[model samples]
Target: MSDSRSGLFGFVLNGLGHMFRGGLLYWAWLALLLVLIVLGGWHYYLQLRDGLLVTNMSNQVSWGFYISNFTFLVGVAAAAVMLVVPAYIFNRKDIKDVVLMGDTMAIGAVAMAILFVVVDLGRPDRFWHLIPFIGRFNFPESMLAWDVIVLNGYLLLNFGISFYIVYNHYQGKEPNASRYFPWVLLAIFWAISIHTVTAFLYSANSARPYWHNALLAPRFIASAFASGPALMAIGLQIIRRVSDYPIRQSVIDHLALVAAIALQVTLFFVLAELFTDFYNEGEHAASARYLFFGLDGHTALTPWIWTAVLLLAVALLILMIHPLRTHPVYMNIAFVLTVVGVWIEKGMGLVIPAFVPTPIGEIYEYAPSATEIMVSLGIWAIGLLLFTLLAKAALPVQCSFLREKAHREVTHDDA
Candidate 1:
């Protein structure tokens, strides 16, 4: 047992050493990550000194790109549950191959989501007040407090499950059965809770007609599944090109299927919203008009929204066609485009429309201030850096550990 433990320690250290000595692409990515971190840190300092006034966010447009990114990332985080359910619960082999990748992506996305909220807060320093036991939770009433609980809980669930799986592989053992099965169940429920709570956060604001509908939760889930699978597909392609890890083409095909279904659901919900707005012709219709057309003398965001719709159509077309979806190059291009298009739609498109005819009947537009943009970029850089290092250390074990253990078992049996 001690020998086995020592071997595992050596394996981890060796993986780290290899990453430091890895190819130019690895070094280049790390360097770019460092630059982003420095710039982001500097911007955060400026924001601290200048305050929220530095941001284009006014009383009308209180939530801007920051909140948009937060909303989008929560979906990304929830998408991992899709993979988790299939792999661990239903035992789907096609998704099992890429489950670790999905798990890693979830970790990265959740970390970024939390960072966005921290940066957006009026008093970032007071964020520590949410710490469990030490902080006031005001439960059963405050939806925001519930959001904090669900988000943090979901993060822990993902991290714990991922860590156990990786560590077990490192030790040449399959994960403990008791631990694995329970977390799988936890992950499934936690997945729904995270996105549902996020939607509830918006819907709870009855004054915000655009977000008040009962359909918000379903819409959020639909958007999340679409964008999340698209991102996973893109990440898989990157891993395939960069490393020796084997990702079966069959797995890519399965993810493509998921992306297609998600896109369809997203389109359905969006159309439903349009129908409700046009059919009703109330304040809600007026809000929808600003999003689809233009109102209050504001037309800057209309073109971008149309562009997002066109890109979504393109993505759907690519996925719906068999040849396009299966062709690696074309599929990859479509996946990247879809991810970017959704980010724009969910981040900028969703945010701007909510504030169109402000509560006080004035128009307010929001663009991320230089400091806000820089701080956001920095958080992204940090997430990338953490993920890169984690992949550097963890990927090797995942790729070879199981095979190594099998070989050892065969040797022992022969002996």
Candidate 2:
């Protein structure tokens, strides 16, 4: 018990140290994030003060960037399961070292996804209306309610499993967390379900032919895997450089393999969409037209969409080439570009399609208002800040364990 308390104290102090010592870049990022949050808050205040008329979103483009971000993040959160299944279940020793990092990132991603939903709400104060017992369950009938349950359940699963692993490490015990293996499996299925439900949320609204296809769910999964792993690869690279943590080259090589496969799958889905849309020559094709060329007189989004596609192609090419994927500098560049490309593709691509050929057969384009952009930035900042602090606290222990293992090996060699 005394040792447990000491460990807890040490954890708290270590976290505080990271908070202070996270350096100028960390603080600068935090400041930028805070500024965005403040600006978003002020914009939201004006929104509340003036009403929904503050921005361009109407009955046609009701969802906009917030909803798009929400959907994309669901995929991001689900990507963690890819890492977990291989490391914990298959006993992939290379990934074993970084599985905990994957879990920690899942927690942050899910939290941010939920935050985007909250910000997008017309009446965010009424968010508690979904609470069980206290609020209505409306199960089976309400997709939103289902989303709440699955998302919260998945969040708890991640938090529970992650805390268990970290706590055991703190006590210098081999985690008996294997008992929760079934729960981890359950979480994996739940991860898929969360993203599927998100896709369904858009698809079920049959009026929006752009999102109405059966392919949305599978495409979402593919995109999630590609973007999520790309982000993770970049994250691992950063940790390796900044701290004493020793992520093996083999681990990076394997991750690149995963990224490569996911990128291929995502590209296939994109091509499939093109084939379906052009072949059909239907209203659905209109959305693709808006994305590729322009719709009516609006071409604002076309250039940006093509730019993202170009970057994605470049990133995918780098990942496919063995020399580029193995090189630290090139791999990191590819990962960063891939993540940015996906964000643009998912954020604008998903939302704008729904607005084209509006309900009355009109087209309206959305550019996020200053306030909306700030709010989004704020949320992103919060995710980074949270991950930074958590990484600071958790990484030291993992690094220490790896160092001890290296020392043991060296001692054995000497003997």
Candidate 3:
């Protein structure tokens, strides 16, 4: 037992060593992320010193870029379910090879999501108030409390599962499925719950009629499915090119198919929502009007919403067509489009619109100030940096495990 523990410790140290060693481009990438982090950290310091006045948020439109990003990232984190479901439940060998990347992504994304929430708080010091026993933690009633639970719970689940699998791989042993399979099942359901709870956080706001719809949760899930797989597909291709990890074309193709179908469902939801809002335009339709078109000459988000629509439309066209979806170049193009389009639609288009024509019948146009932009970029850079390091460390161990498995299989065949 002592020797085994020592071996595991050594394996971890070796993985850490590999994380720090890389080529010039890899170092440059890390350097760029560091620079962005510094710039963002500097701007965040300014915001902390001066308060939210440094941001464009106000009484009329309180949730701005920070919450927008938090909302989108929750979906990205939840999207890991796409990979997990196939790899474990259906037992797809191709997907199993790269599912660790999905877990890594969820870790980075949830970290960012939590960071965004922390930064958005006017008093970051008072965050302990959300703690269960130590803080107020009005659970079962407050949706924010629920959000706190699901997000943290989901994060812990992924971290525990990933650590188990990665540690086993590093020790040159296959993880026993029975030991971890139940957790995988829970993580899958927990993934869906995280996003659903997030949506409920917004929809529970009875004052915001725009977000107070039953459809919001389903819309969140659909859009999440689209964006999450699109991102994983892109990451899988990059890993295939950069490492000897044996990420199969079948995995990429599977992810693309999921993204395409989810994109269709997402577009349908959007259309249905538009019709519901416009078919009998009235007081409730005010927010929709302010978003897509101009309301009382306040056209700030009009162009932005239309631009998002155009991007999603174009991406949908590209992804839905079979030939284009199968073509590597066109498929990648569609993936990029889907990510950006969903980012804009779910981020700016969703969060900002609901607050446009405030409850008091006053319109306030809001945009992220330079400080908000810089801080947001910094948070994003932090997530990317975390993912880069985690992937760098885990990929080598994964590759080694695959080689060992192949050898064992050949040996068994010969015997």
> Highest TM-score, which number?
3
In the range 13-88, model 1's lDDT, one tens digit per residue, is: 7657756877888899999999999999888888888898888888888888788888889989899877887888
Q: What ranking of all candidate models by lDDT puts the best one first?
A: 3, 1, 2
Q: List the residue pairs that clash in candidate 1.
A: none
Model 2 accuracy (lDDT, Cα): 0.80
- The Cα error of candidate 2 at residue 5, in Å, is 3.4
Question: How should the candidates be ordered by TM-score, best one leading?
Answer: 3, 1, 2
Q: How many backbone clashes can be found in candidate 2? A: 0
Residue 115 C-alpha lDDT in model 3: 95
| 1 against 3, candidate with superior lDDT | 3
* Model 1 TM-score, 2 decimals: 0.94
TM-score of 3: 0.98
| Per-residue lDDT over 145-213 for candidate 3, one digit per residue giving the tens place of the 0 to 100 score | 889989999889998999889888877789999999999999999999999999999998888888989
Question: Where does model 3 exceed 4 Å of error?
Answer: 1-6
State the displacement of the C-alpha of residue 76, model 3, in Å, after optimal TM-score superposition.
0.6
Q: Each candidate's lDDT (Cα)?
A: 0.82, 0.80, 0.91
lDDT tens digits by residue: candidate 2, 184-222: 889889989998988887788788788889998898898
Runs off by more than 4 Å, candidate 1: 1-19, 405-415
Q: Which whole-number lDDT from 0 to 100 does residue 225 have in model 1?
A: 88
